[model samples]
Target chain A: MSERTGVIHDIGYRPYTGPREGRWGIVAGLLRHGALSTFGFGRSARSKVLPFGLLVVTLVPAIVFVGIISFVGMDSELLNYAGYQQVTAAFVSLFVAAQAPVLFTRDLRSGAISLYLARPLGPAAFALVRWASLVLAILAFVVTPLVVMFVGGLGAGAEVRDELPRFLVALAGALLLAVLLATVGATAASLTMRRGLAIGGTIVVLIFGLGATAILQEIGREQGVEDAAAWLGLISPFVLVDAVQHGLGDAASSFETPPDNPTTAALMLLIALAAAAAALLLLVRRYRTRGSR
Target chain B: MTVIQTRVLTKRYGGSKVAALDSLSIDVGEGVTGVVGANGAGKSTLIKILLGLLSPTSGDATVLGHDIRTEGEAIRTAVGYMPEHDCLPPDMRAIDFVVHMGRVSGLPPAAARERAADVLRHVGLAEERYRLMGGYSTGMKQRAKLAQALVHDPRLVMLDEPTNGLDPAAREDMLALVRRIGHDFGIPVLVTSHLLGELERISDHVVVLDAGHLLRSEATTAFTADTGHVLVEVLGEDAQSRMGQALAARGVAWQPRGQLLEIDPADAPPDALRDIVRDLAAELGLGLVRIQPQTGRLEDVFREEVPA
Candidate 1:
């Protein structure tokens, strides 16, 4: 036999006399991994199938929307950021519902959060950082296509002057939607340690909220209750955000009767902020009391 | 140095009348100190309180000079914890998970990876470190958990049942690893066990807890040191009286109990007393059953406290 070609050295436990990065280092590490795990990185190949598939599903429509504007130069309703989100809401909701538990439930289920809390990061900060990572990932899902459509349309000869304002409005809507979706996801997922249950719960909130409100608003309008239908616009996340943008005079409302004054926009904004804050508080409490142990 | 100090720390689950940890105090110093107790003895609760995973209902504690209440984050930064339950993410490789935990313990990425590898090797998982942890054995999983705790090179490590569910050989290996951490590396270790026998050999100090109360906290020697007594048993119809009277004739102080004699072995050399007892029994044509020194075991410490 030849002499040994490999050696496994027992370096023993050496004092880590090196620099300790403390809180921000933990934050950065968790955030980076948390965001990546949303897209199924650092996990199994089987885990990658869903998030990557959702990204492609989300991207294909974005590519086609830009293609239609470029080839036909059609004055399409699906030309703006909020409009893009409106069209892709189902796919984006599916993505968030399916993947949010990847970040939220797996850690809680495995009792890994206790180890995390055993670090310098507190339970509240842990929840927030995890919330931020999902926000980043969902933003990527919403923005990747927005960027594609913007550049692709510009390449197809759409004027920047005509498109820039609409682009900015959609950008703001995407941020708000991402934040709302992430908060909902964290709230739903952290409530249970079961991944399937968490995913189903998030789907119910994101999709059920949008579906129920949209259907009710349509029925209310057909029943000649236009006031009620418009008020129903304040119910779901996407329509509520659309109402806000419309109130701000940037986009038309998805509702039959759009908000005519800025007061409704301000009121809706306040409600949205309050709701998001409540959901975030739930996440923090869950981490502190249930998830950490 | 006292690495952990607690005073009147208490934890009570709301509905349960019995407090999990009821007004307990202990000062653990710079070596392997074993927290020995039976099931539901609040060992895990104590660990959680120290790690700041659960807040105490009352009183105060400090870990590495940081208050457990206000400075939980600082204590967490300086201390590593190996939880009793499963905490490893099964889908990830050992190296990845340990590195991730190292970062969570506040080390930067490169340092985290470097120390992760070193600690994994130290835990004897170097060969299998690249495999997903779900595929590993229980011993491997335990070592992986230990590796994450040591990866940050914490000032102290609080391991909850480190030898739990291991076969005897594996338990021996883990205890040795724990001793090396406290002794060779000079890092303080607070290890818990349900069995006193396992920790008795490795721990420099043993703290016995019974039902949310401290039974005793003392050096290992205080628990195991020999007392100045020896027991001798002789076999015969009237063995007890014959041996006692024979030892008295030989000027050895002795007390007769059924089938045995308790000798103080006072003044005379212990070996001499043993020889005389043997010679006396033989001359009396009696069967010498046994001669033994009565050294205190850590278990005896518990038995003494709860004598029936």
Candidate 2:
């Protein structure tokens, strides 16, 4: 009974990979999933209204304002063009970050996750595919605007020789921020099957992470530790983006380069990576636990 | 090779002393194997573990030669599962959902699409395949779920309560489908349901799970055998008394039971009981309704096995 079955060499095979291919594989997967989910977004009457209402109420106004300002011929130079980048970054973060948890959380809790798990897929594959999908969704909501801003900056007679580097820097910063947030959101969301809990929990963490600076300030003022509080403020990816943009300059504005603090920057990067990794681990643990149940 | 094997497979929830599957060890060969148990009999636990969806404590098992502990990914790929719950994504179309499942099972883009269509058609959902599953009846949803499981062409398919919420007519249809899947398609199927009589009707082999323990596993035919008791009915005045007197005069062993006479046809040829009853009825100018051999039902065996 214990004898081995005949080996099917072509079976259980995965292809070899290079770094660039792997990254785009993740990217393509995310885009496809995001597009598909867009069609299946509303399952219940209440959910149907909420997301559409949010898009109309929150996004429509911002999109219109961006359009109006761009057309008004206001000194493109005075717009703190970096502010536009930040706004776009925030939009991406908010949309992608909050959605990450809802993706798998709802499916699993509803027992829809079991449908996929019973197939040829495993935990790792499931997570990766989902993460890729979320990143693309974030791109649609967040990254597109930054690209528009960069193109606008170029059309306004901003020297490509000078402005191109800043645009690249801004794009890279946005990618890093979105990836960190999406990874965290997805990992955390995968911990439960309850969509409401997952979405609410992700929002709460983002709010805390965003507001950690102020909390630290109150603690510092009460305890007399201003410098440490200031440093703690840098823990936020939002603030980290601010620092990166502040250092990198805009299409129209350049500042004296500040000395790079390698240790502090490395520590912050490590923290982001760790949070993302922890979320993934928690999700894996959740899948294991639910499977057992 | 055995399609499934478990050694003392047990699972406990909420720290209760009554295990969901009390040291269940069973082997499943090719063809449809029906699992029968009451609502809380741990039949679901056994299916879940075999599909690598549940982790069994204090036991070792394998499905399709893949270890349940380490090679779950392989087992899951090779086995199809239809859960008892209403697990369908209501927003998606039936064909779309099944196609996605096929892709998840490692089929390439074109192949998954092709297989999805084939499966949906096979499950009798060809016309409604494009409709959102939310509007489907319980029977339609069951077929859609079954379509997804069959989409990947798995070696073994485990359907947990496939007729759970179906009407009697729908249930009979599902049972027929199960039989065809096993015999016609030649796929080994493991289906679970609390309806013992239903399983007896369709299943080639039946395994009874009682309170997380294996009560019995045997061929369905063997489980429901013809008892020697013969049911004799005759039409006349004082039918019971006259029947009894005739059997006594012939010195045949019998008992008066309700409006009929019961006889133990021991050591008699197959037609001997019929011959005696017919001749006696004719001589007494009595009309005989039936003289059939008494047979046990699957429900009777279930009751006898688990006394309440």
Candidate 3:
């Protein structure tokens, strides 16, 4: 037989893998998948815009009232940078915690997660990429507000030039809080495919953590144990940011002695980072064992 | 060598008395291998397990030399699967969805997009691929599903009920595409269909599964080549009666069946029977419309194996 006939015989008159194409394997897995799943992120963005718009609407009235008060020559710090930092931490942590299940669990329950798992990428990479995108989204929600507040404070002439360090610290603290809450919510949501139940579960978890602190502090006050009551405030995400803000401004920390102190701040940072890492591990494990024995 | 091999694979659903797939073993080689079974015959179970989408309760199977248990990630990357249900995210466009699937199979961005376009065109969805799949008709949706399976360009493609929810023309088109996928493209295609007759036409080999058990597996030719009857029809009134009388006079083993006469061609002398039947039909002022041999149809085989 001729060479061509031999090749045809090798092809065996059956379906052949159309051109033997070259691939770089898993190293390129991330870039290629990131490009493809851009559509998924686009879909997620479309779903988030309305709620984000609602949040903007809610903040608009406050922003306008603050602007009006500043414009009327009131000798007041309506755009107080430190005060806004407290709002930033509260909103970022609570909002991310409440919304994580909506953004994360819906994809899994809809079987869209199957498409990702079916890819050449492993569960570890998939979990990390998804968590990263979620963290970026949460950061946008939290950081945008803080940036606006900083500019507003400058415009309000609250002598904010000397307070740049404090503002920067607050920004970093808020970002860490946002990332931590987003990861926690996403991890909890990953345990179940049902979005509503996952969201409800996340809310209950956050409430339990922060609510118990508030209740403990109230009871401690009744028992006349003021120092013990103060310790319970550490559970609140807002309190952590307030502590950091006060520490940056040379004030006694609300959370601990010197919020920027290597020992105390490092411990807090470790706890937040550990939560994020644990959440990532849980998500990866769930992805690996999905629908399997 | 077997492209796919399974040994006693099984799946038991929750609270179910019987297993969905019970210790079933089958081998598939390259070509169009049609998996034939009725509803609830464990066809879906087998495909899912082979795709590594479902974990088996026991036993083992391998696809393209990849173990079904631990090597599922590799198996999935190498194999293409078109699920039976309406699993498509309807809001996405066909091209985008197929491109996404291609990327998932490790295709680079440029190659995935190029293959997606080519596959969409190949499936006859060139224009409709731009529209969201939600607005597509059933036939179009099936074609889109088919396009995604082809977009990845894997070594083996498993299609589940590609003709489901299709009209006759659409079903024929789908089957033709399946045949071409095997014959024209030289890609091994394992397709499942509840209709055995359809599979018989397109499949080089057919594997029959009946209630979680292997009923039959052979080349389509082998199962169909053993019919004992030949049907003879004459083009006139009373053709049946006249043919019956002629056969009886010759002592040929035959029976009258509806308008035509069914005769065991083996028992009758071939030349003499033909001449006698012709002469009798002519003498009775009738014409012989046709004389043909009959073989068992796949549907008949299915009915024999699983009665409903």
Candidate 4:
């Protein structure tokens, strides 16, 4: 051996001695990250257009409806809160279809789920966090326009005291719609790693369900089957939201007349709940089994 | 102390008749342990099972004293894993990805960011950390993967095929970094490779698996223990044969090993045999170049120990 020696200089790789939060902190971080990804926060500017554009599209009608009503000095009661959701249902569906893949499919396609699962967060927690973010995103989309409209009615000199309760009920209806759309959208996105396929699948499911249920309800109406027509409305999430709104005595249905009886409202609520739960369960199972791989 | 222990562990895929790991058992101590095998010899499967990514078909294991069955989360929190495949998100910058991974491992945001920067620098990716991972070279991607694994400051790290696609110089750099992780930082490292000889230089202990069965597990020194033979080189013409004949005439057993003469000290001690060879070469008027004892190699052990 040669007579040479070497010294190792310190590079300062200090271990993290700081406080480490537990599972809840991890879940919160993942939720925040997923929510940001839904709107393409950390991504390139080109990626931001679709989700935010649809969001703007969702808000435009509310702004125009409010602007026109305020400027024309029409009855402040002209635009109902629940009726706004019905009118904007297409925009909301498209928003979910476009953005849900950003949250769900990208992770699966890029193998980022492995990194996520390798941490303290379990597969169920991962699924729940993503679902929560999608719900929050859809909620923002649905509730922002309604809030703008509510404020516009106030600015137009509408009575605040009488309108506040209806506004709150409409918020509830909007939340229900957000949860339903999030579940269906996230479930569709979770089934595939292809973004285009996921978007197509979500749009097809929502639109086909709406069109099919409307045609079936028309057939029942021609046959004079009252209860059957009301029951058929449950097939579509849009009609289901309308049925719930009708039960709350807030707004009238735009597609098919809302169910008249309490039993129909209960059935619609039950079916919606079951579908959301089933979709959530599918998500949890899918991640639990395939996420580890 | 044992860092990882498995007892009768077995794993079989859904429709396969052959088990990936068949009732295998091993105890790995706290140091750099090299897991070597040919393709489909269950090296990756073993690492996956240790990380609690894949559940065993039977039996059990523990990493850092946490059960692989019920305490998978706990095990994962303490053990960092660098997978063999390309698992990084293409659109995300390396710094953001590493910071996010640090957060997922439970570090607070500020601490995660600080640690991410430090680990990136330590892995020699400080300048490239700001760029998106999609544009990174294979070497840079491998370093980024290594940085994420170290960012958590885990008790033990399991690296799978970290040198898979590197050139020779990069391979040496990575091996040196692995040695530093185990020796300088005093962290336990469990690294796997399909090539047996690649790990021979840095691993303190080597475990060889053949067809999912344990072929050998021993200290690196034990595998490379000295063989009782000294190789002799000379400068004269017909040097090897001349030295061999002269040594044999003097009752010293010797053989020609290529250009060098190998002297086997049958019953004599090495020092005495070396002196005898020196004297004999001087009297024979042969120019003695060098003489040194031969040490065993891992390739020799493989050829001698592995069953056909």
Q: TM-score for each prediction?
A: 0.91, 0.81, 0.76, 0.90
Relative to the unseen true structure, what is the C-alpha lDDT of residue B210 in candidate 4, on a scale of 0 to 100? 76
Q: Please provide, for model 1 over A36-109, each residue's C-alpha lDDT reduced to its tens digit, 9 standing for 90 to 100.
A: 98887888889889888888888888788788887777764556666777777888888988888888888877
Best by DockQ: 1
Give Cα distance to truth, residue B199, candidate 2, Å: 1.2
Q: In model 1, what is the error at residue A152, expressed in angstroms?
A: 0.5
DockQ per candidate, 2 decimals: 0.65, 0.24, 0.22, 0.56
Docking class of 1: medium
The prediction achieving the highest TM-score against the true structure is 1
How well docked is model 4, in DockQ terms?
0.56
Per-residue C-alpha lDDT of model 1 across residues B172-288, encoded as one tens digit per residue: 999999999999989999999999998889999998888888888899989888777888888887878887887888788877645568788879997788789888988888899
Give the deviation of candidate 1 from the true structure as CA RMSD: 3.3
Tens-place lDDT digits, model 2, residues B175-212:
99988888877789999998887888878788988888
TM-score of 3: 0.76
Clashing pairs in 3: A14-B186, A15-B186, A15-B187, A16-B186, A16-B187
Docking class of 2: acceptable
Q: In model 3, what is the error at residue A214, expressed in angstroms? A: 5.3
The alpha-carbon lDDT assigned to residue A215 of candidate 4 equals: 87
By TM-score: ranked, best first: 1, 4, 2, 3
Off by over 4 Å in 4: A1-11, B230-265, B268-292
Alpha-carbon shift of residue B144 in model 3 (angstroms): 2.2
